[model samples]
Target: MATQHDERAAPVPCALTPREERRSDLVDALRDSASVGLGAFPMGVAFGVLVVHSGLEWWWASTFSGVIFAGSLEFLFLGLVLAAAPLASIAVTAFAVNVRHVFYALSFPLHRVRGRLGKAYSTFALTDEAYAVTAGGAGRTFSSRRILGIQAFVHLYWAGGATAGALLGSALPAEVRGLEFAVTALFTVLAIDAVRAGRDVPTPVLALGCALAGRLALPGQMLPAALALFTACLLARYAWTRYTRTPYARTRRGGDHA
Candidate 1:
């Protein structure tokens, strides 16, 4: 009788339904992405304004933001497209500009995202802001739903901002001078935040050195050259660190056994 009473009084587990889970995930995503969206939306607006000022149709802004979905690259790509840059040059430029994403992929939580379509979209949507948000310590344990929701919200913010800017560009000044600086400002903020989070001095020092070297060696092509040099240096450092750690780990284990 006592056992029966105990069982009757025990609370039942209350699991969320699928719909509720999705709704909760969306709300959490909105909250997590709010800060990033604040910056991205304005940068995107800047891109759209530039697109219209450059004499392209307003729809082109949405097309680039939605299709390319790369904030920095889209800005550069607009110039290349307007200049009628050769396909080969454009291809090379795109690779050089985005090579850093390869490193980003090494640490991004791609495994947490499920479904082939979901993974594909997530990959396509992987921006600096997304990486910064999801790769942080607090974001390490984010669920698949939350990850997808973050990316989706950010994407919407960019696309929507671009559209709004394009539509409003005509009403604004004929010459918008500082709009182009938005991308640079956004990148600087992200870099600072990353440095703060990691507290890794060597990485930024190495990057600065690479940038200086690239500027000195190839002033016209500094960006790509700097990125290549930085990547090589990072790979070498990773290899050396791993090689050195293995021996110490083995030695520690041996001493423990002895």
Candidate 2:
């Protein structure tokens, strides 16, 4: 048994200064988020430009970026708001478009975030790019500070770029013909990059097949329907693979035991 004085005398672990911890977290976060920030900035600028040209007030760009902070859904909101769609319609559409984020939360490293403010911001900034950056080898083990920093930086990139574009969009041509396709182009690039990185032919095949089926079955609700179908397909594939592999895995285990 140690005396109270001896226990008190024992060395305690050195705690990092708040500033030093923040600096370390910022540096790591910037390193991980730089690519996503770069990509999002240009897209955000495009969005702001589109918003200004759509006869909406310039402030709408900042408003949407700050409030929605959703890339694809923000684009759709432009048309919906412009059309003055029913509130119910907008609500449903927004949910359908962003339902994927609900799934994203299931695997996002949210538990690492501490404090109400940190967790709230983490949840708010849980974009696709953020998820992509922090879902793998080194990212999975990142500290809460680093995770929060990455999310903050990415969020800033979008908000800042949108504000800049809103300011500049007035000088551009009034009727930009192909601006709407930028979102589609961005997704196309992302898809190609994912395929290249994964080399997973079946996923893309399933995605394409589901998208086509959704378009054919319900053209107006294609995106949501396609996502639903794709999810089901993926789940089915997972189950089938697990079922088929378990027997072989058991046999290999038995052989090793023998």
Candidate 3:
């Protein structure tokens, strides 16, 4: 009877332990962040080299990477600082450069993150690369732990690269001609990947149109003007889609009733 009962018993389900789950999350985050890190590290090294060439101490690279964490803005800030620009001018420039982040916030999955501190850090670390990775289709299903881990890894890559570059800057050639292009190259690659993944030609076309319009109309304020025009166009598209869909939906319902 005991042998028969054992044969009839259900098999136990296996589950990952908390430690194992955390390890898995870390691995996934590292894998996902590798591409971004590749770009960020070199860009960081370039920034550090520029800092030393610009006569700033090595520590300034680390400080900017850790504190500001905005790649493009950091480069601009370095020049502004060297020129002794007014604080108000710096603040305005910072706002204009980073205003696109406001749109990023609309779609970022902050609610999935657990702790208050985690959310705060996530918000602070929402770089373009991070947003691109986390807002992509594959990233939509990622856990909060994985998302945070990816950001942390990318931050480390930038910080470490900056420190290394600062140490090596004194030995390198003064010109360092092509290092400045790393960030631009990285952005181009990211934009290409985004276009391929989305397979949406019209969006890029719309963006290009807006950019041209901004350049022609508001040459002095191209970035902000382009962003504003693109945003308005997107909003208009959304409203039109909703309006068209509502009547169709109601028509379908009415047809079903008839």
Candidate 4:
């Protein structure tokens, strides 16, 4: 019963959409995330080089990249986490900013995933970009190999890029200082692509509405607020559909597909 993610182009529903058995587009997407890491790490390295003159070695930055797994938020919170930001504040911020994820969980049909690890990693791989790819419905693969591969690819890319930047930051020039801006630009394009999809209208609207509601009602409770709004709407829609079915006219109306 396994289907390839790439086979959606055809109605047969057996082939995965990964293009090839071995290649991964998820890794390809990391080209952007990697650029962000490389650009930022060099700056951090430059700072370390200037202050301590030896440059950042490792341990700290790599751990941050691996564990934190967020780019902008990681940059902003690295210092704060090291400083005194309450754990609650960090949690609140994460929830509020990422509240839209709750909506994503709605349409994801994981019923076909086979084992515990497959399901676990599939959910784990569901990052912002991963979710975009999934909800974008690029290729429907019942086998999660490519999906999990994508996550692993991005994870490796981040670690490698950060390590490279941290080590080379001091030796790099100053004009390349703001390269991190490219990641933001890339994501802007991704956002535009997602908006143009047309099919995502319902999801995005629900996400935007929940976000607004969270800003007003929950403020710091982004995750909970988003979940509440999305759940309420989903439940309401389900109830309406369940209770209000239109009776089909038995008489010939349009005489066809109607």
Give the top-scoring candidate (TM-score): 3
lDDT of 4 by residue, 72-161 (tens): 456556556656799999887666566566666865545544589988876754556555444544425424555565556665666555
Q: lDDT of each prediction vs. the true structure?
A: 0.82, 0.79, 0.82, 0.57
In candidate 3, how many clashes are counted? 0
TM-score of 3: 0.81
Question: Model 3, poorest ten-residue lDDT window?
Answer: 249-258
Give the least accurate 10-residue stretch of model 1, judged by summed lDDT.
Answer: 1-10
User: Which residues of candidate 2, in runs, are more than 4 Å off?
Assistant: 1-17, 173-223, 241-258
State which candidate, 3 or 4, has the greater lDDT: 3
Q: What tens-digit string does per-residue lDDT give for candidate 1 at 1-258?
A: 234434334333596655667789899999988878878887788888889989999999999999888887888999999999999988887887777787777778988999999999999999887897888665778889899999999999998889888989878666445655555665677678778888889999999999999999999778768877998998788667656664435445333432
- Model 3 Cα shift for residue 202 (angstroms): 2.9
What RMSD, rounded to one decimal, does every model reach? 6.6, 6.5, 7.0, 8.6
Residue-by-residue lDDT tens digits, candidate 2, 1-258: 535554344333596555666788999999877867767887788888888888788888999997888888898988998999998999998888887676676568888888999999888888887887775545668999999989888888888878778889988655445554644655566567667766778999999999999999999778778878988998788667756664335445333432
What TM-score goes with each of the models?
0.75, 0.72, 0.81, 0.57
Candidate 3 local lDDT, 33-79, one digit each (tens):
88788789888888888888899899999998888888879989999
Runs of candidate 3 with Cα error greater than 4 angstroms are: 1-13, 174-201, 247-258
